[model samples]
Target: MTIVRATFLDTPTGETAMGAELRAATDAALRVVDGTIVERGAWADLGGRHTDDDVLDLRDGLVLPGLVDTHVHYPQVRVTGALGMPLLEWLDAVALPEEARLASPDYARAVAREFIGGLAGAGTTTALVFGSHFATAVDALFDEAQRVGLRVTAGLVVGDRGLPEALLTTPERAYAESIALARRWHQSAGAGSSPRTRYAVTPRFSYGATDALLESCQAVLKDVPGSWFTSHVNESQAEIAAVARLFPDATDYVDTYDRHGLVGASSVLAHNVHPTDRELRLLAGQGATVAHCPTSNAALGSGLFPLRAHVDHGVHVALGSDVGAGTGFSLFKEGLQAYFVQQLLGEAGLPLGPADLLHLATRSGALALGLDDEVGDLSVGKAFDALWLRPAETSPLALALRHADSASEALARTFALAGPADVAGVWVAGEPVKS
Candidate 1:
């Protein structure tokens, strides 16, 4: 058992509505045993209560819940800045060919090491990642994640057509391989039968999926309890047009997945930047969550997401690095990007606060992945998936936060200036993975 003493911040109850109260605790202490946080409160209070536990004092630093990423491509790590081609064209030019390289087992393992190490260095403890086309590559990814002790929910990218021949797979092969991988790793345990990973049913997107592929994806999710489904939707003008042309029978882009029984509470769809008002309503009604990949959207020239509208409609939204389309893997930068794009939308944007942005990067993404109960916040019964931020004296963020009179102001400064350099440590399941 261990007791961590630190200044803590998290949105314990989930996203705060605009101008609503944000949940935060200062000078906090967490009591962790068997990889789960058993208690949390003001440091003085918990110190008195848990005197027997070993201590890791981070009292001079800030401890935030480990960031949760809703959408990131494991195979697209190296091609981030190949810019200006929008969605379809960019995929054709660089994304596909780069992803295809993972077909080599050795190359896939090497990239997996880089990708998982990058996530740890950026302080992301939990992520819903898009995996490679090759099942062996996906195997390498899961193996590396376990070896590094990060919480990853990932799967093979299933595509029947509209992708490179090297990346394509028949619907039958997709179903067999996806389900087999799930059987091998989904809800899998370490030595104690305590689960540290999950499997998602992932089809590349509307462009790569035929009706047969999507139905097979639905089967994988249904056949495996606690599994999830994720894919892209309404991301760019050209992608939307092509999807519309491809699926004329469907009413809209969101409908393309909904008709296949894929939209629901456990499913996560990325980049609803161009979703119609009706689609937003359907998403909210169906309890589906959207991963607002603002960096990727802006990078690909995808439209600004309707942040305020989604909030007004009660749609659940989370942040994603969408790495490759997104320039980096840091969820803090993703938070900043989300705020920047919404600000670009003027009055259409929500009354965003730093706490809201933090929540989007952590709790909201955890909720979207159905792991909110286990990893989202610093609440009791949650695992100690957390990041420690220690601002250097020479850093401007330190000076700015020093004068901030409120928690909100200080948190905003943290997001504005605290890049990967400020992350002093990272923990997953009560154990340090980065320090």
Candidate 2:
């Protein structure tokens, strides 16, 4: 057993901040223990706290739960700047073609390394990622995540129809491959002693996946019991119209997935820009999560997400970069985008504030992925996954809110305005993955 301590900030409830200071600081000490955190009257009574472990003092840097990106495409990393088209056209022109390359194991493996490295470097430790249609691509991502000791949930993109032919999976093949991959990687252990990888059932979106294909994906969930289902819903105007045309029998775009048993607690539906009150109510009733990709929505002209409405309705809303369409891997930038998009819609006024943004990036994101209990916070029993930010001498966080130039600057601004940026290191499951 080992004990490492530092100034800690965590959100015990979604609304309150819990801060603690340890007398002796040890850098990344949780990597050694196994078992639960013992409670000691509002504090964790660490039973076997070791005093001799290596120490890492963040020098008062802000250490919060590692950022969680609820939505992103691993294969789209190469097409970051492809612009102008809406979701459907973009998918046809740039996204699908690039994803087609993942059919090669070697190519998939190399891309997986880059994707995970990029996410980690940006302080994202947990992500609900979408891989190419190739099952090998999903496997490669899981393998790379295991190597880096990051907590990742991903799956094969099951677009059996309407996608580029090279990137398509037959309905039967999609089901078989999804099940095979889930059984192999979902909840699989990492290089460490505990399970670090999980699988989600991905159907691309209603437009790309045929009714038969969506059903097959739902069937995989029924078979797997606890498998997660991820898909795009109500992202763009064209996509919405396409879904209505494709599934005329369904009342709306959200219903297409709901009818297919794709809407539920373990499901993550990206976008909801055009969802109706009824759709939002259905999502809330079903305990489904909405991954709000504000940057992507804005970039693709996907319309502003009704964040206030979703929050008022008690729907679980998390922030996602939605890379390629969303533009960056940093959840901090995603938070800033979310804040600005809502402001543009006049739904909320600015100085949207950093604490709220941090909550969305961390706790809210984890909740969306059904991973709130394990990650998203710095509680003693939770996985020791966190990012240490080092602010510039003038307090970069403060400068960010007013004069931010880059995503990193925005993150520093988040810490300054709402929290602090003393990130001297990052730890995943008690192991220091970066410093």
Candidate 3:
């Protein structure tokens, strides 16, 4: 058994529902048995109770829940900051071309290593990754995640139309290949118990699929019990127009997926930046999550996300790096970006507190992925997925945490200034990762 004492912070339930309240332990201690968190409480009590256990002290640093990134692209990791172009044009010029490179099994394996390394290095313990087009490449990604012991939900980016010729998959082929990949890795490399990996049905977006293709994806979801579904939604005007053009009979863009049975409790749609009121209501009622990608939205010149609008409607919200277009994999950057976006929106934005920002980076994402019962907060029953943060000694965040009068002030300062490099240690399911 091991014991770690630090200044710990988490929001047990979502911050929005908890009145933006923070659950803090100024001098917190955690007890781990095997790979599970056996106890978490005030350091004074747990430290005295577990006097014989090996101890790790984080005197000045903060212990935060391991971050969960609900949306990111595996193949586009190298294409970040292909600037000055909007969404569709960037996909045509930069994104798709880089994704096409993953057709090589050898190249895919190499990219998978960098991708998995990037996640852990940035303190991301759980993620919903966008997988490569090729089954061999997707396999490499799952293999790398298993080897790293990272929790991931990912799948092939399937579509049959309105994409580069090299990336297209026929409906029959899409189903067969996706099911085959699921069979191989869906149960944490098919290990049969509490596996860290799960499969998702990821149709690239509505514009890329016909009814035939999307129906096939729906079939995969039905075939795999406890599986997930995800795809892009109203991220850009041009893309939304394209979707409308393709699905003329549908009530709206969200309805396009609803028609195909892809919008539900198990589904996560990326970038609802342009969802109409009707769409928001539908999403909330259906229990789907929005993988909010603020950096990607801003970088690609997509409009500001009406985050408050979704929250007010009771929709589930989570963070996504949406890398390549999103800039990087650091959930800190994503969290900070969220703050900046809200600030830009002014009063129209959600009145997000420090605890809410941390919740977005950690718990909200887990809840969105339907893994809340297993990971997310420092609650005793959850796995010990956490990070030890040591900001630059003289940096604003570090100095503020040193002098702040209370936990709330320290947390606010850390969110305002800390980055991934500040993460001194990362643990997932009680084991250290990120080298």
Write candidate 1's Cα lDDT for 38-142 as tens digits.
987777887887788899999666889999999999999989878887888899998999999999999999999999988998999999999999999999999
Task: Rank candidates, lDDT, best first.
Answer: 3, 1, 2
Among residues 3 or more apart in sequence or in different chains, the pairs in candidate 3 whose N, CA or C atoms overlap within 3 Å are: none
1-435: candidate 3 lDDT, tens digit per residue: 988889888888743422556888877888988868889888899889888999978766898999999999999888888888899999999999999899999999999999998899889999999998899999899989988889989998998998889999999999999988898878744544338888999999989999999999999999988899999999999999989989999899999899989999999999999989999999999999999999999999989999889988888899999998998999888888898898899989876778888889888988899888988888888899988888878877888888888777888888777877888888998898854
Please write out the lDDT profile of model 2 over residues 325-376, one tens digit for every residue: 8787878778778778766877343234555677778887788877778887
Q: What is the Å distance of residue 260 in model 3 from its true position?
A: 0.8
Q: Give per-candidate clash totals.
A: 0, 11, 0
Better of 1 and 2 by lDDT: 1
lDDT of 3: 0.88
Q: What C-alpha RMSD separates each model from the true structure?
A: 1.8, 5.2, 1.6
lDDT of 3 at 95: 95
Compute the lDDT of residue 337 as modeled in candidate 1.
Answer: 82
Best by lDDT: 3
lDDT of 3 at 143: 89
Give candidate 1 misplaced runs (Cα > 4 Å): 15-20, 188-194
lDDT of 1 at 435: 83
Ranked candidates, highest TM-score first: 3, 1, 2
